[model samples]
Target chain A: MPILEVKNLNVSFKTIDGVVQAVNNVSFNVEHGEVLGIVGESGSGKSQSVLAIMGLLASNATVTGSIKFLGQELVGVNTKALNKVRGNKLSIIFQDPMTSLNPYLTIKSQMTEVLMLHKGMSKHDAVIESIRMLDFVGIPEAKERIGLYPHEFSGGMRQRVMIAMALLCRPELLIADEPTTALDVTVQAQILKILRDLQTEFKMSIILITHDMGVVANACDRVNVMYAGQLMESGSLDNIFYEPQHPYTQALLASIPSLEHEVERLATIPGEPPNLLALPDGCVFQGRCHKVHQECKGGDVVVQDFGAGRFMKCNLMQNLTNGINQGITSNVVVN
Target chain B: MEKLLEIKDLKVYFELKRSLLGKKRIVYAVDNVSFDVYKGETLGIVGESGCGKSTLARSLVGLNDITDGNVVFLGKDNLAKADSKRWHALRQEIQFIFQDPVASLNPRMTVAEIIAEPLNVYYPKMKDEEVLAKVLDMMHLVGLSDNQINRYPQEFSGGQCQRIGIARALVLNPKLIICDESVSALDVSIKAQIINLLKDLQKKLSLTVIFISHDLSVVKHICDRVLVMYLGNIMELATKEVIYKNHHHPYTQALLAAVPSANPKVEKHKHVKPLEGELPSPLHPPQGCVFSTRCPLADDGCKSARPELRYMDDGALVACFKA
Candidate 1:
């Protein structure tokens, strides 16, 4: 079974203005020991979907549908029961290490608290374990630095501490949200390398949420392209990078500047993302999609299933693929 | 290409006043950096955090005091020697666009007022109608609608706020504009839009821009030439092609290699050796080269003597003995 399976997940927030549908009916699966990347622009609801799984939404927000981990339904579960799985079996590393870590607490207390709470480890044993984890994440003199406060460490070092804290229990699944966004390129590279190595050592599945295509390409085994809270495309990293079917995915890939080649002008999807409170009746990306067609204006756009664990939500791609599939079947019959 | 600006041995140091018992210290933020920016070209300055790229940009606009060296503009005006009144006048010809779009803009002010503020300060005697026309024209150039001019920055998204920022920068029709990580805070799609708009405006107005960013790919896309800095020192200065393809300095190579490739196939085949160790504190930088501690090719010679920037066979300037 997959490590995580999210089906038709929707998250909405009630504000003074109206209801803001942050995450649409998003569905995907993370296989065991595989890295799943969720790529999207801001307001695309990539972060919200993961937060929904962790049961960390705001008080005014509402969530529906199923989020199953190891064949167990997580939605609507009591907080006490959910807490047992959270921070132990399933862990998350936040975007900004500076703000996520408590300013008043030292690294030793913050890290040991997790082990003591989850594993019932003694303070002495927890300290030893915390130091070992920190050393594993490449913090120099981990033993001596364990007593330092978060402010004492640099940006990269703080991020490493966050990673070590997240893996304190050796979680089966890890969720890292823009782990390298605030870091410099060289430091980001080092962090990514550590994550890659840790995944191998612990055999843990990871859900990496980011806006950078470069990071997705480098780290993720599979990719899901999100646009305006909807899943535009879901497939292997190679499938998404080399053969993106959805217009939103294609436009996103074309928009990013490549390190290997220089284009005369980057292709941009004109117009801002749709306002959540007043989204269009048709496709979520219809306003900015270059290949938007009349069918897309119709109310419903079904997810098209291409076999071999690939899917896309676009009316235009569905028609094209249907034609190709029919041609392939007819050719097989003739043979 | 004509030389638009010349920076000679620029230095910006911040003194740390310790307690009476402790010795005083100085943070060498921008130490002995010299370069020339050509007219009608986008010069990109790239480095890690605390590498003084922002300090270098702020120094050009008089936002930071120059501890030493000279800033010669247009080969005639010695900006380093300019008084307050002269500096105030020079501000009309040199504008700046800040990094954070939302934070940089005043939330209380409307888009029209924000863009018109520059004109109001520089030409107070001009008619209100003339100011409104210029603001409208600048808004149109930066892709903002005229109807939204009355809306506050809080009503707009990050991308639109950036457009407002660009409009304000262009309202004065400055010869040179300094963008300190202007597009770094934006999303990828929005970043592309801003880049395309900047490139278009650069061509239409023949504007010279100094763009400072940590993203190397974005720098390659928009910049004509790139300057690589490390710990307030210029490690490499060359055209985009040379900097990206034929870089000599070990720091430049490490910086390039650290950028994750957007293409999976290419990334799979590429071998990346990320630079090790964090940037040394500026208060007590290495006695020799600024990057010697983290440089992979560092040896006794590199650790003992500082390398001076010199011209290479390909016309690129490198500051490493091995290079």
Candidate 2:
């Protein structure tokens, strides 16, 4: 069984304007010791679906369906029950580490708080453990740095502190939401390298939520592409990159400027993501999908199984995969 | 091609007030950087945060004071010596597209009003009707519709707000447009649209652009020449082909290597030489090479003297003792 399975999960928010469906029937599974990437652009439900699973939704938001971890149901659980799981077995690090951390609290206090609360470790022991985790995450002078406030460290160091704090309890699953987006390229590479290494050492599953395809390529073992509150495609990294059936997936691939090749013009998916409050019938991606067809606007779009555990929600998947069916022969799986 | 702008040893330093106990200091935001921008070409300036790429671009428009050196625009005026009156005139030819489109524009101003603001300043003598006509024309050029003319900036999406930004920049009919991470905030699809729009406008108006961005892939796509900077120093300056294909500086190489490619196949096999440590504080940069602290190739000699930006055999100017 997968470590985490989210089935038919939907998230909607209540606003003055109307009820906005932020995540629509999104489902995916993360296996043990795997890196899963939830990829999408802004306004996509990539973050919302995970937030729903973590029980971190806004007060006005409503979440439905099932989120299971280790054969245990997590959906609709009370705050106390969810808290036992969060920051213990499952932890999350947000986009901006600076905001995620309290500006007034010292790193030692913040990190030791998690260890004491979760592990029931003594204050003295917790401090030592916190420094060890900080050292593991490559923070130089971890013992000395732990006494300083969040503002004392640089952007990259602050992220490391966040990572160290998240791993203090040694959680089995870590949901890093755009962890490196705020960082520079060199720092991004360093942070990603550390994350990859720590994942192996801790044997943890990670759900990396990001909009950058390059990040998805670098870190994810399995990939899920979301658009306007819907899971467009889910597959192994190799399958998604090599044999994408959904037009949204294909368009996103073409949209990113390639480092390996230069093109005169980039292939852009025209039109904006659908407004959640007033999403159209049939397909949510119909407006932007380059290969959109008449059937896409007719009725409900169906998710098609392409075998190899790959699934995609698209009306034209049949014709789209006619040329390349089944087995991916030339798969170069990214680390 | 004509040399539109020649920057000679451009420096922008901010003086810090003396503390009660400590001595006064200066932060070299942009330190003795020099480069030339050709007419009808897009020159890309790429660096990480605090590298002074934005400061360099801002100095061209007199947004920041130049502590030293000269900016020769159109091979005539030395902008470093230009007073406020001369700067007011220089602003007519050189316009800036800021990083955040939504914040850069006034939230209360309608799209039409925002676009017409530049025209009001540059062409103050023009009639109101003519200004409206020019604003509408710019709106059409930048892909905004007539209906959005009365809509405020808050109502538009990020891409549309950026379109409004471009319209404002173009309304002046400037010879040069400095886009400072203009498309960095937009989604990929929207970024593509903005990039294509900029390309089209550059050709149509024969406009020279100094595009500043951290993303190298975007820089590679839009720029004819590229300048790499670190610690307010120009590390390398070359044509796109030379910079991307034949970079000599280790800092530049590390930057290119760090960019995670979208291609899974390429990423799987690609070797990323992760740069050691973080970018040192600009206020206390290494005594010798700016990059020597983190450079894999740095030796004792690299820690003794800063390398000058000198021309190489490959027609590229690189700042490294080994290069």
Candidate 3:
């Protein structure tokens, strides 16, 4: 069984203007010991889907559908019961470590508190475990540095501390939301390497949410492309990178400047993302999609299964399938 | 190519707070950096944060005080020594597009007002109708609609706001425009749009640009020549092809290696060892090479003596003995 399964997850926020549908019918699963990447532009509801799973949404927000972990339904579960699982079996690392960590608390107090609360360990034992975890994440002199406040550490070091804290309980599933976005490229590379190594060492599943395609290519085994509030496509890493069927996914991949080759001009999808509150009647990406057709102008576009764990929500699938199949065969031959 | 701007031994220093012993320490932000930007070319300056790339850009526009250096614009005007009146005149030719789009723009001002602010200041005698026509022309050039001219910055999306920023920078028809990480804060698709617009504008206006960004991929896409800096020192200066293909400096190689490849196949097979260690505090940078502390090929020679930037056989300039 998969480590986590999200089925038709929808998240909406009630504001003064109206209801903002942040996430709409998003579904995906993270396999055991595999890294799943959720790629999207900002306001695409990628972060909200994970926030809903952790029960960390705002008070005015509403979440529907199901989030199951280890065959257990997490939606509508009481806060007390959810708390037992959160930060214990499932842990999260946010984008900015400075804001997520308490400024007033020392690293020792923050880390040991998690152990003492979740594992019921004594304070003395918690300190030892915390140091070991910090050491595992490559923080030199973890024993000495644990007493320092979060402000004392640099950006990269603070991110390492955040990772160590997230893995304090050796979580079965880890959700990292742009953990390295605030870091330099070299520091980002180091943090990613540490995460990759630790994920293997602990045999833990990871959900890496990012807007960077390079990061997704480097770290993820499977990719889910989100547009607006919907899942445009979902497949394995190779499938998503080399054979993207959805127009949004294709445009996104084409738009990013590549390190390997230089293009004269980057292909861009013109127009801003649609306002979620007053979304158009049909497909979420119809407004900006290059391959948008007549069928996408009206009625809801449903997710179509293409076997071998590939799924996409688009009306042009019937026309694209044969061409993509041939491309896949050619890709295999080239490989 | 004509030399649009020439920087000679530019250095910017900041004095730190006095120690408890009442001793003053100086931070060498831009330490003896010299380079030339050619006319009608996009020269990309890339480095990690705190590497003095932005400081170099600011020094050109007189935003940062030069501790010791010469900024010669058009081979005649030494901007560093220019008087206030001369500085005011030069500001019309060298405009800057800041990193943050929203924060850089005033919320109280409308888009038309924001774009016209430069014209009103530089060309005070121009009529309001002429200013409005110029502002509308710039807005149309940057792909913003005329109707949105009355809207404030908060009303537009990030990409549109960036267009306004670009329009403002272009209104004066500056000979040299400096973009300091202008697209770093944007999304991929929007970033691409802004990049394309900048390219088209550059071609149309024949503008000289100094593009400073930490994103190497974006730099590679838009820049004609690339300059790599480390700890306030120029590590490498070369054409984009040489920088990407035949890079000599160890720091340049490490910086390139650190960029994650967009292709999964390339990323999987990448064999270059990732760089180790973090940037040391600039307040007390290493004596020899700024990157010597983290360099994999560092030895006694590298640790003891600083390497001067020298021309290589491939026509690229590198500043490492090992290279």
What's the DockQ for every one of the candidates? 0.85, 0.82, 0.87
lDDT (10s digit) by residue, model 1, range B152-235: 999999989999999999999999999999999898888889999998999999999999999999999999999999999999
Which of the CAPRI classes, incorrect, acceptable, medium or high, describes model 2? high
**Tens-place lDDT digits, model 2, residues B215-266:** 9999999999999999999999999999999999999999999999887788
Question: For candidate 2, lDDT tens digit of each residue in A239-316?
Answer: 788777677887778777887899887777777888999999999988876566899996889888876668899877
Count of backbone collisions within predicted model 1: 0
The true-structure Cα RMSD of candidate 2 reads 3.0
DockQ pick, better of 1 and 2? 1
Off by over 4 Å in 2: A319-323, A326-335
Q: Which lDDT tens digits does candidate 3 get at residues B169-229?
A: 9999999999999999899989999999998999999999999999999999999999999
- In candidate 2 chain A, where is summed lDDT lowest over 10 consecutive residues? A326-335
Write model 1 residue lDDT over A93-180, tens digit each, in one string.
9989999999999999999999999999999999999999999999999999999999999999999999999999999999999999
lDDT: worst 10-residue window of model 3 chain B = B270-279
TM-score, cand. 1 vs. native: 0.96
Q: Pick the candidate with the highest DockQ.
A: 3
